[model samples]
Target: MLGAGAVLGLLAACSGGGSGAAPRPTSSGDGEIIVASGLDVTGSDGVRQQLIHAWNLTAEGRKHPARLLELPGGADEQRSQLLGALQSGSSQYDVVNLDGTWIPEFAEAGLITPLDPQVKADPDVIPSVAATARWKGHTYALPFNSDVGLLYYRPDYLKAAGFDPDSYPAAGMKWSGLQTMIRQLDTVHAEGALPGYQRGWTSQLAAYEGLTVNTIEAFASAGVHLTDPDGHYTADPAQLKTGLDELRDRAGSEYTLRGALSSYEAQSLSDFTAGRTAFLRHWPYAYRLLPQSLGAGQWAVAPLPGDAVLGGQDLAVSAASPRAAYALELAKFLTDPKSESCLLQAGFAATRDSAYRTPPPACPYVSPPAGSSPSASPSASSGETSTMPRDGQNRPLYASGTLRTALTSAVQRPRTPYYGAFTQALQSVVHGWLADPDPPDTDQVARRLDTALRRALAGR
Candidate 1:
């Protein structure tokens, strides 16, 4: 499914140089400040409710009480609906949540307004995460929780294969080193030494924006930047080939789970939760919902073998909203140190620096909202992937500096107005390479990507 990344395809990008740029419905939403967010499936609804509840207690909060406008889940549909609202000049939504990759397209289109530069810079957020809000010299959005890929592994499985479980997640490991580990675990599982573990490794590699992210991380880890120093579209074919080659290795039969072709972030987590996979590449939210059965010693969160692509959602004032001022204030409230701390402890990672440094509050997580329905994309909950996970919101996550460090070291996907098309092109070509009977001659594929990216930039 195309998403906020795909929304880039829905709009016309730059002609020459310059730019532009979920919620559930509530009865109280009418006439109140409306925040449209992709539902947090990891079940952070209580955090949302309490934040709004807390806001209403203040004098200003009562005057401009914020409520949710749940958008249809998944990137593509959410983007389409949001674009339709903004383009149609609807005043229905005051605050809008955004995927960082969609910043260029919306900014270029003038569909969202730039926010306060000071507030954008106020938080001690990870630099890369902070960068998503400031594009082309202006800050257009507020940095909410940031996502960088972490390698979640079954410590028991690794130890069974004669590997040190604790050594892996503390720092970045080489991709080649990970492959060695995967192969060892694959063999171990095959020999029935790890009975419940059915797969060696799994990740968000399906033909969607997630593939684009995974592919970009591969390239970025190898020092390939899709944009040049000036932030213009440029890619070295050889470098791209190197990255794609690594992806091909991971997609190999030995490394992939049985339903690997269909896996996204949620599915990967589900498999991991069921003890079907030994290693998982997912975001921080997974920790909140992780089964108690696995427990702390059984799993660990560490940096990906290479740097990962940054993710998570952001908040913006819709250019079409009538209450831009109110919306901005509401956004500030939600992303403020206190609210962000609440979010951090609740499962959705926080974008505020203070949230990470401070101790988590007691009982930060809340129970699932009454009558919460499952999304069409089963397991699709994270706003980073799709929405938050629906299954594991109450699960507790232990704090470590690993995730914070991952955010600092993570790479971002290409910053282009045509991110949707660029992502589609990447997903298509990479999927083709993975599906090929013969290993792809990635040099040829690189040339194709070069053409594809140029065309996307040209808005063709």
Candidate 2:
């Protein structure tokens, strides 16, 4: 029930810090927690705008507050900007917020400090965020707001396809099952009673982080291996082909529609909410906005298919910061339920397990009826009917916690120093996959991706 404005007010209060003498070049500096965040602030959905407001509200309650520097827009741009600022001779940023996936790159590059000491030392932190904060053998960042890919469904069209409103997928869990639904929905659309049946699924397939996340989830769900346990790219031709084939098939299927890949955040939401798409795969942050964005009775969330590859932001002190202990304290506090709730209330998903269990009133996405029970089962939920009984989207995985784990283990997309190149390669393939079925050379695409993954892993 917390509006965006209220959350912004809260962030502003939480970021109060005295502007004393700026610190020197060394990590050991004077008293100041110069926190720099790269959250979008100017846009309507800007997280930083809300964070600044929330920080302002929490400032009165904090024993010690930090000065927040709102990094400018552009995820990739902010990375370079913050890095330059932090590495500058007179850098003042004590705690740096980083993209969760980039933690490995940053940690290995020594751009961020190891968090093992803080993890070992801090007891009040959330377990999930704590676990992700550490990279390699040590912790590198404290996960701030966690996001996961969730499957969105419309109960209306799905039921029209003769999908069991209750046991949507109890009979089969294969992508083939969803394919049947999409094909039927397409038929129904042609009949004109339903809007021309579009693909049942929508996702960010453009060459961006959302594309990476969506493609990886499909690969993982299909049981593909892009890497080994030691984080090596598996060049196994069969495995690589299998992954690419599944991605291509999903793209070809009737239900999986090509969304506005260029701008995932705004465009995909528009497509799904406008009823142009039947199902959407996106992060949880969309849940709060979708109701308003899509209108009532238009949208609802089910547990993401197969599982989700959870992604999020992390808070870590720069290895170069002198206020390591204080920064860690602030990290621990911000992740605490009270502070996390403020962010959640404002529309961010909390990374803490505790926040998941006992969400503050502000967070609308936290209470999915499954509560915090880790082993919650989606189909096993007591016979509670969906609000829209006609929609045939996947059965709500509201309580199913195992589905999330299944997704995380399926694939860890090829990580590399030139992630930009690897992602570009993926963009090429995704475009080919979505084009009219010419049966593009799957083998060639696989080889190209395999080579790219290998090069990235090898740091070439």
Candidate 3:
């Protein structure tokens, strides 16, 4: 993955060359519409692939077959590839699956076309998630799925530390209360009650977008918004200092797993699953993946302490596509209400309100085995048997209650045409402070960060 500074430089160069008008649409000889996206985290032949297969069976789909071309790498790599392809007209992507943070950049650059007003006004779309599809007051995409950080913990570990697992209120937990639990767990570890217990918690703190995300969550929890809704820099040195203090406490050596300093999502998850930490801060997808490793009663998930960050991808029609109308139809079909419900059952966080509140009809693509109950063990696509508990509706037991609440209240990262530059500057400064053995005074670091952000937002 590209480091923050390198990504910033690339974005600066791209923005310096002003964005021209979109290319005129032309008819294509071939009938295929290409959809470019990051790897489906649900594993090979995931729900996303299955959805495309379902679309192919429709009359409209049969005429214009939609093909998914997955970009291989982390989020930053995928962003770079999309930017290069769209800007240079090198690849003919009819539809693009974009991360929420990239919407403003893509929209303002004229790389994507605006969608109909109905997409923005759709009552079934979650309000917070729908907001991500718009840039400068115009809807440029439709949300395919939503994501939010959640706290996953080993109930067995909590019980070993002399805490009542049933009485623990993870949903309403605060930072102070979490610290208290960490102290107790530390003591228990010294007594050899918990083997391989390195620390209280683990999270993604590597010097990439993960570092930017972790920093934003800490700032949000401290009641700080670094940038205004218009994408202007808003924080002063004092506000930055306050937020930095909270982050320092959370990442302190005595409380956090040491590996977190260089850990990304995969590493942190591996550490947690290997019993290196009692608590883990991860995305909603972890709920499905964990069942493959941990048994039913071994773990549970709840909203993260304080604010969680919103993460997901939205589907946009390429402005230069020859088949723009058909691309739009395919995007809508993949994000419709039934599709959203199937996504929820397959472990991706569904973006529609109805997907959580109403009992859905049978998913059109997959069916349960004969004589199987509604709450069957297998997921909608993956053939493996899932140990994760489900409710009567066949949704994850915590889906309607715990997961829905988190998505409703999750905070978004800064929205800007220069988000690549913004996140790069953030990760550079924050990671430097966190990695230093003897860091500088909080106020000094805050001023440094404030200066960096101001220049970044100005397209410097």
Candidate number achieving the greatest TM-score relative to the actual structure: 3
Model 1, 373-408: lDDT tens digits are: 352222222333222222332223333367667777
Candidate 1, overall lDDT?
Answer: 0.69
Best by lDDT: 3
Q: What's the residue-level lDDT of 410 in candidate 2? A: 30
Per-model lDDT: 0.69, 0.57, 0.82
Ranking by lDDT: 3, 1, 2
Give the winner by TM-score: 1 or 2. Answer: 1
Models ranked on TM-score: 3, 1, 2
Candidate 3 has which clashing residue pairs, if any? none
lDDT of 1 at 66: 75
What would the per-residue lDDT of candidate 2 be over residues 143-254, giving only the tens digit for each residue?
A: 6776667667776667776776556644326677767777777888877846744567778776666777777877787777566534566656567787677776766554
RMSD in Å for all candidates: 10.0, 8.3, 8.8
Residues 1-460 of candidate 3 have per-residue lDDT tens digits of: 2234533332232112112232233534357889999988776667787677666656667788889999999999999999999998644899999999999999989899887553546888888899889887898998999999999998898898888877664557888888899899999999988888999999999999888888899999999998877788899999999999999999989899997989999999999999899999999888877877887657888789998899999999888787877787778888887778778876789999998998864543333333365644444346565555667776777899989999999999999989999999999999999999999999999999999999998789
Q: Model 3: how far is 422 from its true place, Å?
A: 0.7
